[model samples]
Target: MSIRILTAALFLAIMGLLVAQRFSLPPELTVRVAASLGEDAGYGFGEGLRRGSVVETGDGFLQLTIGVELENLDQAKTILWLAPNTRIELERLYEDEMTIRFTRGRIIASNETDVPLKIKTNYTSHLVLDDVASFVNYDFLETIHVIPLSGSVQVNAGSSESLLTPVPLAIHETDPVTFEKLEVNLEAGDAAEFYRWAGVLTGL
Candidate 1:
């Protein structure tokens, strides 16, 4: 009888440890303050975020001057490289899909996940999985621009959803907010495109 009791106790202990580990793991959607050149390094918006933290669905960010790097560690292998003056939110986080709503500005998305990775803007929808791309949502007079870097980004404009596009393959080097980033001579743009790049600081 004592042996049976000991076995049951061991089983319960193991189950309790598993439950605690699952709960203690980092939130699936985690936020890391993007690197910035200036002292005011982080901006907060939507639902009184006030500071960067794990985001659940419906957490909106606006005019994020300091930029925020988001990673979906559990549900997806993805990261969003945000530019300043960007507006976005964690729109949906589900088992089969993950989506980020881009209201304005730009993003450099790196998505390598099995789940469908989608970005929705006001006018279009994009599938950016299995690739890295840059997406612009028409700042100022410019229209939505898509520039794929390594792999292809599937775009759907004027439909019910929106996807993002890439900038000049060389755009990553001129990170407007970062004072010191690993210099990726990853792009070369024209004079006009370079001019537009200046407005990235304020998300114009």
Candidate 2:
């Protein structure tokens, strides 16, 4: 073979390998659709999600509508229940670490093991180290609600951060005029009702 042709073929082979490695599915990060309700329930990567199918957000952003239970099999079994109008993308899903970004709506993440889970919104981020179950509602750009079922939650808003208990509170971003973060506690029965509404939306 000519030297130029051989060199070109080698370069193409290397590029193909690099692309596959970047986009290939991780064997450790296994996901499945445990339960799906509603007609809009499907994979964000196009086409409907099937049982035991590995799901990735693909390139760019992705969203999940009502009645979707995406389960991740790691040391800690994680179940993500999507409420209505919930738009989210999984940035990483590993045995010890996981990151999920929520664009809007609500999602309930149930972690059965001790793996660390982190959730992100447009203006804020939350790290779940102790809490196994947490609910995040990104209803608006300025307001976010966080409910930690077990342990505590670390709330990060811009440069400031706070530790929250099981109080079920809402974090409001501090506007330049106010220069103060706001947290609104939910009413007594409102927490339960919120979960109930989420369940109803997901048809759980």
Candidate 3:
């Protein structure tokens, strides 16, 4: 009888240990560039702007958010990462270099300029960015609607938006942005076509 009791206790202890380890395990999130608005904006998956952390996950998706900026507005560039349920806000404008990255639960941004910058997010609706200068990157996010809160912001395709060559803009929708694939690149001159393709891919 004593032997059976000892065996039972050992089993319980092993089960407890297994449960603890499972709970302690960290979540997994991937970072990808979501969007950009300026003419001179630059982004890449390698080098100084390629770090990410896990934030949250549900239904085979993770969420993240980040904020970054350029230092000189005359030199340097920026990059970004994307994750599930990510939100970011831009606090400064016209920087020389700026980068934002998001992955799983981790979000990272680097600013070389002397001025201050910030990025905020709304996770309740998956991902919602309040500012256009602020960018987002994620594979799960299909459609991004730029709704102007005050004046108006341009959604540049390749780099910068000019008075003669206007940036493509889209109205916000009640449905979530969906995407078949997520790609990150510098704005060139095809803002309208790219956004139109994204809309079709995301079913928005």
Candidate No. with top lDDT: 2
Q: How well is each residue in 1-204 modelled by candidate 1, as lDDT tens digits?
A: 999999999999999999998786534543343323222224432222222232221222222211223432234356565554555676654445667776666666667767656777654566877776666665453345555656677766444433333333211112121111122222343222322332322332
lDDT of 3 by residue, 99-201 (tens): 2222222232323334322332232122112222323333344334332222233333222322211132232221442222223332344333333322322
lDDT value, residue 63 of candidate 1: 24
Q: Which segments of candidate 1 are over 4 A away from where they belong?
A: 1-28, 34-76, 158-186, 189-204
Provide TM-scores for the models: 0.48, 0.57, 0.22
Clash count list over all predictions: 15, 0, 46
Compared to the true structure, candidate 3 yields what TM-score? 0.22
Report residue 185 deviation for candidate 3 (angstroms). Answer: 30
Candidate 2 Cα deviation (angstroms), residue 157: 2.4
lDDT of 2: 0.54
Candidate 3 clash total? Answer: 46
Q: Per-residue lDDT of 86-194 in model 2, one digit per residue for the tens?
A: 6666666655566777666666676545766678776677776644444555465566777665666676766764555555666665453112333444333434444
Task: Give the candidate order by descending lDDT.
Answer: 2, 1, 3
Q: lDDT for every model?
A: 0.49, 0.54, 0.31
Better of 1 and 3 by lDDT: 1
Task: Give the C-alpha miss distance for residue 75 in model 2, angstroms.
Answer: 10
RMSD per candidate (Å) reads 13.5, 7.9, 17.1
